[model samples]
Target: MNPISIVLVRPRDPNNIGACARAMGNFGLSDLRVVDPYEPVWRESVSAVGVNDIMQQAKRCATLDEALQDTAFSMASTAIKNREIKQEIVPLPSLNERLQVAPEGRVALVFGNEKSGLSGEDIERCDVVLNIPTASKQPSINLAQAVILTCYELSRRPGFKAIRHPGQAPEAPTDAQKEIFISSADVLFEKSGFKTDFSSDQRKALLRHMLSRQGLSREQLFFLKKWADKLSSKLP
Candidate 1:
């Protein structure tokens, strides 16, 4: 089974949620997480044919962070053509290759609400941004359609496997570990008077993207964190 979790952020439509669950079932993708969904109707989606088990067992999270905290890498799906952010933008077709590179942990494919896509903060929480190619005339696609397309493409390689380096390497860093390291680095940068054109948040986001691509092992992350901690300790 693919270690992919389908995450819907603040979904507004019960039917869309049902359809997404159905898509997951179609592709043999089991994990489903809904963040801050519209409470009353989402439960109704359990009635979706052939997906009752998935819908019933879906995890409900209060925040995006909670949904992705344990994942090694998170990809936010966005329909917006042009965004100011500098995170890695991946096309949907190439996602399978991308997943192969991510370290051994659950990968979260995050989608946004039906009316509005992911917020900038939500995008920042993810390691990468996924763009589903569509004509410029109609750039955006439906929420359920996006999930279906992603799951379908991923289903092409049913037995998804991650490629990692050889030799007793440390385990992959979880999202929580990455955040802690980023925070430690942020403190170090601030104390050392590091200068950059990007705001602190933007810099952190860029750092996050870089770390995700680097596939830092847990020991490497700890090594970097220790360096940052030691360096920050000397600063006033």
Candidate 2:
């Protein structure tokens, strides 16, 4: 099973939720999380034929943070826009390769509401924004359709195997640890006069992208965090 979590944010319909559960069953992707769902999922499992077990096992979270706090990486799904994107945007085909490089932890693939989609804060909270290719005439896809498509693609990818050899190195940092590193680095950059070259958001985004791509081991991540913490504390 993939270590990815499918997060539905503020879903307002049980039918759609049931369809999503059914889709996960199709791909053998079982980890499902619903944030602020409209109704209890078990109440609507009638539509999710043969997936009652999955629905019953799904985690119901009260907040996005609560849903993703344990995730090592969060990928936000949204429609593509033509404007300059400050965050890293990965294509669906290349996603498999990206996942291979991502550190070991629960990865969350977050979907927005059926109508409005993810909120601004929800999008920002994610590490990457994933956009599926669609015709400009009909850019928006249904929530269940989106889940099925993404899960289908993910199922096609060669899954990640856990490393057991002691020489394999330490595990990757959790999603929360990465956040701490980013925040501490931001403060250090300002004190070191490094923020002058780029805007704050831009720098933080760049730093996040860079560290993520490096695939830092837990010990290596902590080493950077240690210095960032000390340096930030020394600043006026």
Candidate 3:
């Protein structure tokens, strides 16, 4: 497997940082880097549970540039798409595809703050932008959940190869991919004249559950994105 590092920038929540450490360890990824963290809570390892060792060994840096210094490729994770960045804002599955074929070089998955997410400057530092894709009404996901979802999606791809029961079917959409598809669908909802005041996160969560049950594939995801784009273009 290629070397992959998880980089957190100005992370404000201690529990979320710890949970990210645990999530990394869950998928056999231990290289963690924190940039300009205000509290340094991850150093104490209080929230990581059995993966405290991973947190203990994580590196700390004074800036995002410093944290990503050794990485050959970097991806910025954000909830909102920053129009200023010229880099492609790829969905989670597209990222997985690239990682699967990437050479053995340092790769960093950069995450931003819990509330405002990565700034435009932060996104510019990355080669690509990764959006988890949530509903239009409430397009935010929890920080820890974002880490878990990203790590879990990467783990499901060929490079990570997470172990599974012999007869059990694989998970569909993975959590990250499902979020992108649902978010794409939400773009269509806006075009359909649906009210944007509803609980979109809850609705997307339900859609994710239903899609998981149906076992969606890569081709299906492409089709959905295309359909949504066509629908969104028809709107005023």
User: Which candidate number has the best lDDT?
Assistant: 1
**Model 2: residues with Cα > 4 Å off, grouped in runs:** 40-43, 82-84, 159-236
State in Å the error of residue 169, model 2: 44
Instruction: Tell me the spans in candidate 1 whose CA falls farther than 4 Å from its real position.
Output: 158-236
lDDT of 1 at 76: 95
lDDT of 1 by residue, 1-236 (tens): 33889999999988899999988887778789999998676867753678888888999999999999989899999976667777998999999888888788899999999998899999999999998999999998999999999988897774653232256766999999999999999999899999989888997899999998999899999999999999999999
Candidate 3 per-residue lDDT, tens place, 1-33, comes to 568899988988887889899888887788999
Compared with the true structure, what per-residue lDDT tens digits does model 2 show for residues 133-168? 888988878999999999888877765332223375
* Inter-residue clash pairs, candidate 3: none
Local error of candidate 3 at residue 166 (angstroms): 9.5
For each candidate, the alpha-carbon lDDT, in order, equals 0.89, 0.84, 0.80
Q: Is candidate 1 or candidate 2 better by TM-score?
A: 1
Deviation in angstroms for 235 in model 2? 99
> What is candidate 2's CA lDDT for residue 210?
92
Structural RMSD, model 2: 22.9
